[model samples]
Target: MANFTLKVTRLGFSLLQSVSPRIAGKAAFRLFCMTPSSAPKGEKAKVAHAAGIAKLAGAERFTLALQGGGKAYAYRLNGGAIGRRARYLVTHGWGSSSVYMADIIETLAATGAEVIAVDFPGHGGAKGRALHMGMAVKAIAAAERRFGAFDAAIGHSFGGAALMVAAAGMLPSVPVVLPEKLVLIGSPSEMHWLFKDFGKMIGLRRAAQQALEKEVHRITGRRLEEFDASAAAGVIKRPVMIVHAEDDKEVSADHARRYAAAGESVQLHWANGFGHRRIVAAPPVLETITEFLTGDDSVREAEIVPLFDLPARRMSL
Candidate 1:
């Protein structure tokens, strides 16, 4: 059914491209930003279970009023310590909700740090059918304002890119101050790559693609290329850990390399076996992330290592 729907969508866009490429491009861009109604792969049950994991871990579930008209669902997990510890923010990828990051949030909480996980608008418990980077940035800002400033943050895929863009204070709608430490897992280097990839997937023509870019510019008040995570990392003088799997089919490893090259304090950690989605929950990846956030910063940024003790060659920039 999905394949058939995709085919029909492609045909409709193709016809629209023939008549008015600008209209087709605008339509295609909207399709690109559409959020999933249910969890990815139709794992609605699993997502539900993950959502309850936070509550089971004694997290205080709350809803944050966003700057816009929507509200974001968030889970605040207290650290296992008595006094105040480092606070952390965890965000999930596109087509996913904050429930998916429940494990990571719990793990951070166990480390005696307050952990807050927020679902972007149009995802998780948030009500909407559309979402964009600007919406995500505002969600993060709203979360920060409701809760307190976080000492560190971790994000996967689209969430990571949004975190970077927000931290860089690029978007005018939500001027945000993100955590000093960040970990981006399987995230794209630039928004332009995502725009191009979506266009290719939908079989958009050149004119449609140009129109899509123009529409994005009109919405964000900046070119799509301007929303580069590498550029965000370059300007922020904070420690950033870029974790990517060599075999990740969704996002290329080159994005991780670009981040490492652009940021002076950025470290790249390669993982094996764990693909784009699984890397968020991979034990080694989580362990390395914990170490980066809580442990001493003794690891050298130049020398890259495999997060797992697999028989993989060391990757370097």
Candidate 2:
């Protein structure tokens, strides 16, 4: 009862954080960082601590060339406490770096999974490259070459779109290279929609949106018909989980609905207002993720973890 009260207090305070977007983002981030951790269940804590220590030791930052294209880059975080591992790859979205995905990586790692989280072409250490889905597909392939076949793939937003293309048979082995499951966080059903929405956020006129769409075509070679998630979703054979925030002002809940409607093996879970990026590290988000990756497919919306691990959340910094 005390623990529940503390969580509620923390969340209520979190809600009272500054209203300015920038300040609010920073405050929420700080809250996630400075918040005291609840003692993990004995086994869970051991797993997490062991994984953190080993991750510190086994961490390898490396680069690989995309077969015929340029080089791709990523970091590998191995739970040093374990020998072999079930593999998982996580991809990050625009405006955010791979640093945000570390929380999820550590949680899964503590469970004895080998984890690789990649920065997109223009994000994280992947700067100096253009943002294109094909480039992201190559990055996933390059990571596979270095890390071996993965048991799962979880991508947030734009990164999810990249993996979606890879799952749709753009990679060398197509669905074979795809892990047993694909998880998307606040992911979009259409790349064009994302571009237009982003345009509006930054004050782009309709004319500008149309012009940008032309550039998207020139760069990605994806026609308007091919822009929909349905194009690639049909080829994905593995189970998929869509995680989104119910009150997100950025990516709407409709994105999840569209994905669930079009995907062959798909699950959707809605959460509190963690928005587009914060949702990445939120506890409810991770629970849905852990459930899917571990094959506990009976994940009802209520099963989502309401509280987060503060230490893992701080690792983002």
Candidate 3:
């Protein structure tokens, strides 16, 4: 992890040399669009995405690709229009689009609940130089407009972080009538840690990491230290469900604990085999998430170490 941080740190101003100023401004933007896939990004992502696409049927189709949250770009996957009660709002992580969350959307739809999954700004179809708290809510509102309102909220990685922020943080708070139950998958309890870790994975050094922090402060207008998910977790009044894989190589299971520690209302579930993406589709996970959406709190606490039956490597830049 230290080495990864060093790489990103190494990339600081000197790394910027490889790209133009126009590109550096957009580098973070491009990074956000990369999504979380185990395969090599770029061509491999396109291929893997094709496989994910091939699996879709019925209302599971990822359609209406467009910019959302008033950002430069965003994508929306409709789980076939809104139903009367308890809609499901799905959001994806950094560099990802609405496509990957299709299974969860479909599973939610199968339950007769409306599902609207959106790709946040700087990812998928959403357009923005970068993702901000303001834009995240915009994507949430965009889904609400069409799907009526979500009774539950689900997100992965960065999306998971955004889910908490959208539910508890953000301006105006999007009217309480939207999503009441929140689900975060593989997202850290602290934003600063998340960014710091992300920088490490991409080869950032301490100094470079500081530069990254500076950039974060400059762009988002908030101190990186202040963006603590645990603090944010405190403000969320509704039930927050946290799901993490024991074998997850990226975000550690400790992150899940952080969320649970933040508030009494938070619930943590440690899954056995399903990694980050597949967890959203696993029937057992689906059962757990669906139950949570229905306001069931049957999940019991267990040793988080058991989750890592298989050790996986962390994210590679």
lDDT tens readout by residue for model 1, 83-154: 778889888888877667766776787787888888887887777888888778888898889877889989
lDDT of 2 by residue, 143-218 (tens): 8887788888988887887777777754343232577788888777776555544444433344444554555455
Candidate 1 TM-score, true structure as reference: 0.89
lDDT accuracy of residue 215 in candidate 2? 52
Error (Å) of candidate 1 at residue 63 is: 2.0
**Position 288, candidate 1: lDDT:** 83
Q: Rank the candidates by lDDT, best first.
A: 1, 2, 3
TM-score-sorted candidate list, best first: 1, 3, 2
The candidate scoring highest on lDDT is 1
Candidate 1 residues lying further than 4 Å off, grouped into runs, are 39-57, 79-83, 301-317
How many clashing pairs per prediction, in order?
0, 0, 29
| Candidate 2: C-alpha lDDT | 0.63
Task: Give the least accurate 10-residue stretch of model 1, judged by summed lDDT.
Answer: 308-317
Query: Candidate 2, residue 267: CA error in Å?
Result: 0.8
Q: What TM-score fits each model?
A: 0.89, 0.69, 0.72
What's model 3's lDDT at 76? 32
RMSD of each: 3.9, 12.2, 5.7
